[model samples]
Target: MRDPLTEKPRRKIPSRLIEVDAWIDSSLWRFGHGFSRFWESVTIFSRRFRARGLNKLAVEVACEGLTLGVAGLIVMLALAQPAMKLTANGLPQQTDYSVLFLDRHGNEIGRRGVMRADAIPIDEMPDHFIKAVLATEDRRFFEHWGIDFFGLARALSENARAGGVVQGGSTLTQQLAKNLFLSNERNIERKIKEAFIALWLESHYSKREILSMYLDRAYMGGGSFGAAAAAEFYFDKDIRDVSLAEGAMLAGLFKAPAKYAPHINLPAARARANEVLTNMVQGGFMTEGQVVAARRQPATAVDRSTTTSPDYFLDWAFGEVQKIAGDMPHRNFVARTSIDMGLQQLADESVEYHLRQFGKTYDVGEAAMVVLDDDGGVRAMVGGRDYGESQFNRATKALRQPGSSFKGYVYAAAMEAGFKPDDKISDAPITIGRWSPQNYGRSYAGTVTLQTAIAKSINTVPVRLSQKIGMDKVAALAKAMGVESNLRGDKTMALGTSEVTVLDQATGYACFAAGGMTSNRHGILQLFDTNGNLLWDSKRDMPPRRRVLSETASAEMNQMLSQIPIIGTARKAQLSMTRAAGKTGTTQGYRDGWFVGFTGNFTAAVWFGNDSFRPTNKVSGGGLPTMTWQRFMEAAHQGIELKPIPYIDNTMPERKAPKVAEEGDAPPPVRPASLTTAAQKVLAQIGMLMSSAPPLEKPEKLAAAAGDDNAVGRR
Candidate 1:
């Protein structure tokens, strides 16, 4: 303000304001420079054209045309960069996800993901197939460059006459370009780009190469993509083997794949195929007689059995796969499972039939079965009566009391503690805490051998033994034998109050079958990726089995259990062809019944109950469960040779089976009938007192006095 003459005191400008001012000046100068360059280009072209001695009107019109051409070129250049970025390298590589499962013998058991055929090459395609595609898709494919001008005129006239888009003028190259680079949006700009890219594709590739790309990348019906996949999916045949009618049908799928799918709508598919054949006839590629013969040939479809309902094995294997390869992102993989499909089918049928025939009589609504090898490989599993109705997988998920089946562990512990099969144990009532446990029939057998007690399933013997050996010790033995359920360390636990899954019970029983070695139960044997690369092998990854029970204890326990079918409750489970040993368990209220048994070849467990946990109508493990087990086992062991179990004849060396009690070996001294009345009265009084008293304070002492050895009563 003080120096007006000296360019006025430029009010000391802020540094930021001065920079912004300079930027604005530079931007304006650049914009002017670009405008001048554009103007100069237009002027130079106009001058060049005018210099060729053109008339005034022609020059004006030529300049206008040149201006529009330049504008369009600029617009195309603007779009080309993004289009190039999107397409990258022509078409994207297809990533298809397909999973196939096979049994141990490599027979296809089931499959997951969309069905696809093998890849087919264009050179191997027949001339009839190529002609069909060309006649249906593009009539002027050989004559047109990229955009079919005559075809466009014809299509426009046809559409105008029909009042709808009855025909499309797009060449095969244009369709390929749209599929490769752009979305399926119909607009003026997209059409322009499609035309341009079609020209580009035509210039870069031969007619055969273009057709090959088109056929290879086209999407067909039924989750199949390409000619090869379509051929196999529809006809169950290779691409080279597809007949003339089939090829025409496949080509017709290009219009509306799902709408004209043969499996979905045969009439629509056949009509479309007829239209293709007519086009072929018009194009001079097929005679009317050939068309008639082709029309007469009905479509041959793939078998539907390959897509049958998957069993429990597949459900279990897929869950494990998810755990191994979290989220299962691969498009294709192979799961090799241990299931025997034939046995699995039999098991499923058995379960359904049993439920239908005897469900109401037994008051049972559901059942589950699991068959495992001694090595812990699950061979077959039926989780429910109907897989379509529910996929709960009860064999591996549902937990119910094992009941008497768990008594094996109690006896196993007793044998470990130096108890023999010939040892005497009391079957009389005993009081532990406020609970007075009684026998199953409320009857007692006095002075019975341990083998007799087990054969008869006396409730008092196992409880007495569990009390003698700590309750915790019995539970520990059960865990070591592969029972994974939580068990209570109470005297009542000897009665199998703990609940366990059928899989765990089967695995636990398998440990006994395997001679005291415990193995990890699993369904999948191996897994592979799409390229046949091994992903996981159960044999390599599974932990080695540990010897949990001694050979003596295992053999003694198996021998005692084998008596169940021979003389005890499970008499119906006896097989005519082979011998089996197992235990039957029925819960207190008859709510849950189980029969877990094993032959040398297979160990199986069956459970019957209502999912609501309501009590069944007096259903016992020895009845319906044993019946189902026998049915499955009879079928499973039909053609297999019999082999002895690990403890078929193995017995304890320390204890020998006692001889039958003779007349002179009787207890409570017997006197001649001529004895005095005073002695008889005294004996009668003592008998009354003994009946009222608890079991002998030291039955071992009485056993000693009676000339018996190793006799111990329940503590």
Candidate 2:
């Protein structure tokens, strides 16, 4: 109607203006109609979804999908330029490296290599080494591109089940990409960059070239960067001359460099190498016979170029670092250790002093010692006679017979079973299932107190005790006391026939000084990275104490053992400055001698023996081990105040009611023989207020009530 009227009125205006007006009205009307239809359709769809109870679900799914799509788009855009630039660069240039190890005081104890190991061409490496790497690291190296989709799927499944990252399924190419270009952080951005670089590597280089570059630049542990360098560093041989076992070990290092490091942990390295050999067999890279032969000839790491007193400490700290944070870098880092350099120096000097004095006379070729605080902080360690002579850490790695030093655990079990220190035990020759146990001097005391038996380290007493209270109890007690080695469960175990590392023995012995509170011996108090970030701290990370022995039993055992440094086998180990309790152990054939002792402040263990297990002419634990212990303890406790250990008197009277003070007349002088001076005063003060208390039970009855013994009705 308006157009008709306008046309009639358009005589005054231009005809094109009237035509434009009609077109605008028609376009607006069409838009309005279309909008009305869209709105109606939306309303109908919403009503249907609500009726089906699917509206919220649909909205949630749509929002999640849209968010994921947007995030993926953003990630792609962010990584595009870096990925392109990395692909253009093709390969990263070499950089300098320096790994500093700090002592407890934050002083640099030693520094590893400052330069990267020399790289070699891939064509020069032996086929066995290359095949070992492929078999152990990635069996589908040739079939996959930069990433292994199947492995990734499996890893995702495993991580989801674990509820955290427990597995990393990065391919060799991806590992090369990460090590070459990206930081060692586990995050989305870094992972994306790693994937992109891996793809770039796969596209740019041939398989052989990629393998060559990877092998040349890979970290093979012990501060070695390439396969060639690792071969040289571990075996002191060229890559072409490395044996199958050696090559397998090198391949195993790619998974965990410090864990499988030969110089750091030879047993772990050998075990990992055995795994690699098995992988090679399964992957058809080597025959079963070849693996057996290779295992027979286990690789021996060459001596390190430089050595220090804290070399063993450094190795221990490195292991702790692995436990705290996996996938650590070889260089550009700092590991804070619990090793007290001053104590370490003192221990080293003391070992050398003993070795030099009696090494020739006693036929002692090697000796190791470990010292720990009451809380199990490893303050000092002497791994071997000389680190340059052999890098094998006997203090923590070597497992030899603990001998009579294990008697403490046996006696502790007996004491917990209601046997008192004053109880008499026969020390005559005893036979159990065709096994006769004799004293060290081939003599017997017939009958003696438990204190005397333990002080003299009479073999027959513990053997008979083990027989009385099942060998299983002894084994359990030993394990509870922190002895990690396997026990024989035979009568001979009473004589310490089982072999145990000095660290385990020392840690177990420390429980006595800690009043039966078991602690794990650790050489790392805290760890700091190159960026000064604290990785781990023992104060916050220490595990809960495992109470293995009752306080009364620990005190009684200490009383019996304290005599060892006074009138027992380790008499020479007595410290004039402080009271010490310890045991002396001499193996059957005199192949190993041990002295493990503890003070109120510290605990220590020493081993003296030949690495070849050759018997010394007349070497016994009472001689060299005691001397070394005395020297080290003397130095360690120079300025520390003398503190008496927790001890219980076996001669204390039975349960009796105290005479109470009458009407605040004077507190009855509660003079208990077993109580210390300070304890007596406190008890007297309490006696003044409690005038009609019940009689106190005996120590044994108290132990029974507390379920610390094998009393009837006790748990």
Q: Best candidate per lDDT, number?
A: 2
Which window of ten consecutive residues has the lowest lDDT sum in model 1?
Answer: 663-672
Residue 696, model 1, lDDT: 54
lDDT tens string, model 2, 378-462?
8888888755334467887788999999898899999899999999978777777788878877998888999999888888999
* Per-model TM-score on C-alpha atoms: 0.52, 0.53
* TM-score of model 2 (CA atoms): 0.53
Could you tell me the lDDT of residue 94 within candidate 1?
A: 46
- lDDT (10s digit) by residue, model 1, range 429-468: 8998899888877999987888888777788899999999
Which prediction has the highest TM-score against the true structure? Answer: 2
RMSD (Cα, Å) of model 1: 25.7
